[model samples]
Target: MSRRVRLALLTPALLGLGGLFAWAIAGLPEFGDYRGPYGYVLNQIVVPLRHSTNVVMGTTFDVRGLDTMGEEFILYAAVVGVTLLLRDESGAGRVERRTRRARSDTVRLLGVLMIGVGLLVGLWLVAFGYITPGGGFPGGVVLAGAIVVLYLVGSHRDYGPFRNEHALDPFEGLGAGGYVITGLAALALGLQFLTNLFGYGKAGTLLSAGSIGILNAASGIAVTVAMLLLFAEFLETYVVPLEPEDVGS
Candidate 1:
């Protein structure tokens, strides 16, 4: 389509999106407003009822999980859209991509050190998300970053394994679908969708919050996959691989 036609279609869509956002934002309580009983109820009940200290996680994954599931679908859909847009359309050869090697041993060493540290922290975040301050989304980002840093430090050979579209895309789709599946699992037991169906486990532990923990994990995986794909695209599009002789230069 011509640019003019594209813009004509896009303009109304942007306006409609803006209007919807405005309508949603308009309903939120103003600053300092504690006008609803829900917040009070969650604070009072989440710990005792859900066996989780982080009331936020309980609210996000159980009390109002459907909203979070919708958000996950939005992100999953975006990744799918990007993958489609970036795919070779004409049955063409692979796009030539370049990897940049770090110019100094110190930088490379630091990157290597950080990889281990980051991996540990990311795993911790995902594992304890339901019990603590972190959750799947943030933890997933950290995990993706740790992996992407392999390429950032010029380990193209190592990064190549992660670059497989066949694996990453499906995993992300599964991660996205995982949340819905977890929600639907409740149906098998005659409970409502997204209910905290299993035992709440011990509070303040890795096993707490029943399906809240599971949902957090699902969101984490989805987020990690989405971020990895996006970072791969950015690298492929913009970074050119340096010559072997340029490795330490």
Candidate 2:
């Protein structure tokens, strides 16, 4: 289309989106102070009905599970597209470039500490997702952050051991596939898709949210893998030399 015509069509759409976004933001409660009826109701009922202390997780992984599945696949589809379009172009197996490594002891020490903290926090988020504020999504990103720390601190040679598709691909597959299998299993049992099938253990415990917690952990894995894979794809020329097997795959 002509530039004028494109602008004419885009202008109204942009205005409409901006207006809606403003409206939504304006309606949000101030931080640390929420009194919405939905929140109140969820606070009361989530633990009793879903046996999950985190109402957000109960809503996401159980009550609105099918929707969450759709969201997870959205990431899956996006990652697949990135892999297909960019993986071939990376050519990490065919070429190697001079790499830069951190030389400062102070920087390395700080990065190592951050990596440790990120790992601990990420695992904690997934472990207590149903009982606390965080869930799979945030936890996955934190884990990815740890990987990023290792990358930032290590020499290209130092990162060699951890920088391959084989090291990262399995988590992506299991995470994406696990979510679907759980839902399908529910169908096999004639229960609602993504139903909370596993027994709800005592609330406020690690095992409390049943399928909800499982889904959260799976999501964390998928997200962590997805993000790391993206990093690998983009940093192929910067990362360690890929193995001969990687070139064929």
Candidate 3:
């Protein structure tokens, strides 16, 4: 069909869906109402069941773990898609040339400092997620930002402990796969998928909230690796002429 005809047919369907979505949202409980059914359930059940004071953490990594797993995979797939789409296929060899402009020593030093601070903070957030506020997603973003800072400081090949880009590929895979494995273990034991199969330590403690800490750590690792790889792909990108003479034989 022609473009105009396709648009005409799609417009009404799109509008109908949007209207339904708006209607559904309008029917939801009032904003900031702690007394709402969902909030009440989390307050009453999730904390006791998960044996963690952090109800949000319990909800995210335990009660609704399957949903979170799907979301993580969505992000993983999106990054992979972007990387594949932006890949350079030219067979011409790479050439590096020094430019006249250079970053100031102060700027480079600042970047180095930020890398240290970011990594520490990121790990802290991930480790304490079950007991405290933040979790894997935010912690992973912080760690990725640290790697980016290292890249900015002209450390193109390595970032502190992570000396090679190839090693990060597996880290991302492990993070995404670890979550599924944890869930499957629960299923194998006759419990629901993603259930907290391990012991729930004392409430408000680091060891509390069985499986949540592991999930958080896994997610953090995966996210950090994926983001770093994405950054490396963009940073190392180059273009070459399509002429036969310029192309490799």
lDDT on C-alpha atoms for all candidate structures: 0.83, 0.83, 0.78
**TM-score of each predicted structure versus truth:** 0.80, 0.79, 0.77
Q: Rank all candidate structures by their TM-score, best first, as comma-separated numbers.
A: 1, 2, 3
lDDT of 3 by residue, 27-105 (tens): 8877875455887878799778888677887888988888889988988997788778876678345443222212598
C-alpha RMSD for every candidate: 5.3, 5.8, 5.8
The alpha-carbon lDDT assigned to residue 50 of candidate 3 equals 84
**Pick by TM-score: 1 or 2, better one:** 1
Q: Candidate 1: list runs displaced more than 4 Å.
A: 1-33, 91-100, 239-249
lDDT of 1 by residue, 18-116 (tens): 999999989998889878888998999999999878888888888889999998888878877877777666745454554556779998899999898
Q: Which stretches of candidate 2 lie over 4 Å from their true place?
A: 1-38, 89-93, 237-249
TM-score of predicted model 2?
0.79
- Alpha-carbon error at 51 in model 2, in Å? 1.5
Worst 10 residues of 3 by lDDT: 93-102
